[model samples]
Target: MQSISELLKFLTGTVFAAMPRDMLRELVLPHGHVALLSRRRADMIISRVRMVAGLFAVLTPLWIVIDLLVFSWPVTGLLVAGRLVTTVAFGMLAVSFRKSIRMREAYKALAMMFGIPTLFFIYSHPLLSHFDMAGPAAAIAAGYAFLPFVMIAGLAVFPLTATESAVFAMPVLCAEALVALLQLDMLNWSSHLGAFWLLFLIATVAALAGMSQLSFMMSLVRQATHDGLTGCFSRTSGEELLDIQFHIASRSGAPLSVVFLDIDNFKKVNDTYGHDAGDRVLRTMTEKLRSNLRSGDVLLRWGGEEFVILLPNASGATATSAVTRLRDIGLGTRPDGDPVTASFGIAERIADGVTDWHQLVEIADQRMYEAKMAGKNRLVGCADPIQYEAVVNA
Candidate 1:
């Protein structure tokens, strides 16, 4: 039985690791796990917002129908009509958002998109004035049905962090209970307090469970996509990022540049000193390169002694200039005072061209080989792979 449980856990973790990148990046970690995460890590905020909006779009209208049928709608005709119209409109907008996502509009649109439904959820009790006639006991019982809805809503949030869930739930419960106390005269103010507190406790527990699920997803994603050695992106994740940026650049007619770099005589270092020294050199070089990159640039540990860089909206010449600076500041020297340096090759996507991301990487890689042949510690950047000169820049 214990073995079976362990196997199940492993499988569950594998499934989480295979989930979408856009979804995983926004997940919150457990308490004391904050040290394991980078708060400044870039998130696919637009993609996540679209996913959330798409879910609510499908859910809100269905909720409208359910409320009208299950709850007393006749006495709340105007409120029902308004809510139905609002939900349908939100659904329509969400459908449009799905087709082509754009930035700068994400935060505002997502705010309005989520804000409308949340406000409706809060004021729903006031809208259902008939709950007063249903008696306090019946009204309170019906309110409990919303617990499932609340849990479902947590999915839209993705990572319902520990305190975050309560932060969102408290207001809705308090508003509902307060409104119920006012409408259902049979429930005294004190009676409403007990209901509110009870629901708060229940919702917090459910929300925390939801958050734990998200944290589990994060752990798997981090393990699968991040390189354990240098804490850089794994090659698989790097490829995904390249594809995403390629499509973006294709649409915008922006240049997408890729650079392939190799540490000069890395094997010599390992054979001469030790594997531990080689690892230290890799970590140090990775940090130096990473710090000098622009905010949007991506760095990947392509393999041992090799790294790949993606520079969106940069041309080959522009990228060459940037990497030359890196060569200038390359690992100054090893523990034994031997000089450390790296070689680079750069390629850029031409506008309205037929080249693919893989092709671009290949071109850069070929130039990297040329750099190795041209006496090492140099860089090559050109549209033609074979024609690029492995110029000594360091």
Candidate 2:
């Protein structure tokens, strides 16, 4: 029994070790990075979805002219109805789309953009299939059949995960299979199979294209939002994150805390040891702070030698305790072989009764300044700075 268990464990470990984890992640899962779903990415995808929908709204109805010229009045009328309905749906989607759309909402819009054409194809294909194949009508039938391919190809325009691309293409694929089933008496089995094979190949290619776009977007986001040296969020992106978290906390009536931290005598490090050593100190400090933070907490490089830590759902007391623990652990050694230390100030939303995120930051900044003045390497986390100051002076 022991041997069997050991063998199973070894086989499981070998299988996992041999797997291409990065490739699997790209193909099977959405990015776990918060920046990937940031408001910037949401807006970009929403704008693209609107543009494609608007284009389809105009193009879908215009195709009715060809239907009228090629087919009989009865077939043309049925096709025109489907086209009009599809056009209206796309138009409504394009016009009603808001600029502040979220990620999930963007995904729904993408689905609608693909779905309208797919429904039109399902309705119109059977109408065209009843007639004999040849002439302009044969050409028209071919156009309807290509709708699924066109929709799958459209996936390349959006930044989507491979999983999202595959899921979106499923409806179009099913519609094609359904339409083919309906026309089995007209076209041979071999033709349906061949068409399905082509679609599968096209979907695979489209998924790869979408994943490439996603990768490109992620690279851009990382460059824009992260600090190049310390790997923490940049000051600009950090402010945006603060605003987002503040509003979320306000809406839910949850406590939000901000910790303003400045390295004690950081400027002296640069003046004495040079800027490269200072940069190393910043990176090392960031690493230590990150190691002690919860997964949901955010660390931002506020500026040179200054950092901000956003602690969502944490009270003033909780943040104070956390910062104290970090202070006790220390921030590693400096180039001069002295231990690095920092001044910390914490402010909580409910405790401070601040109406906006800026106020919260200002309070934390003031307290941090007070900590600096009260002799370096201290924390001022009290809600009432006046009382804390009196005690410090006393």
Give the alpha-carbon lDDT of every model: 0.64, 0.81
Candidate 2 residue 105 Cα shift, in angstroms, is 1.4
Kindly list the per-residue Cα lDDT of model 2 for residues 121-217, writing each as its tens digit. 7787777777776787887687777778888888878877768888899999999898777663356888888889888877876776676666666
After best superposition, candidate 1 residue 355: deviation in angstroms?
A: 3.4
Show where candidate 2 strays beyond 4 Å. 1-28, 35-37, 382-394
Q: Which is the leading candidate under lDDT?
A: 2
Q: List the residue pairs that clash in candidate 2.
A: none
lDDT by residue for model 1 over 1-394, one digit each (tens)?
Answer: 5865575466445545645654443443333222123221113334565555667667656655555555564644655675676666666556554433333344345455545655665555454434454555356435643643453354334344545455556556655565665654345667666666656555644564555565565676678778988878889888877777888788898899999988888898899899998888888778888888997788888999899999989987788788877766665566577767777888888822536789888888888888889877778776644333223332
lDDT of 2 at 186: 59
**TM-score of each predicted structure versus truth:** 0.62, 0.88
Model 1 spans with C-alpha error above 4 angstroms: 1-128, 131-157, 160-186, 189-216, 351-354, 384-394
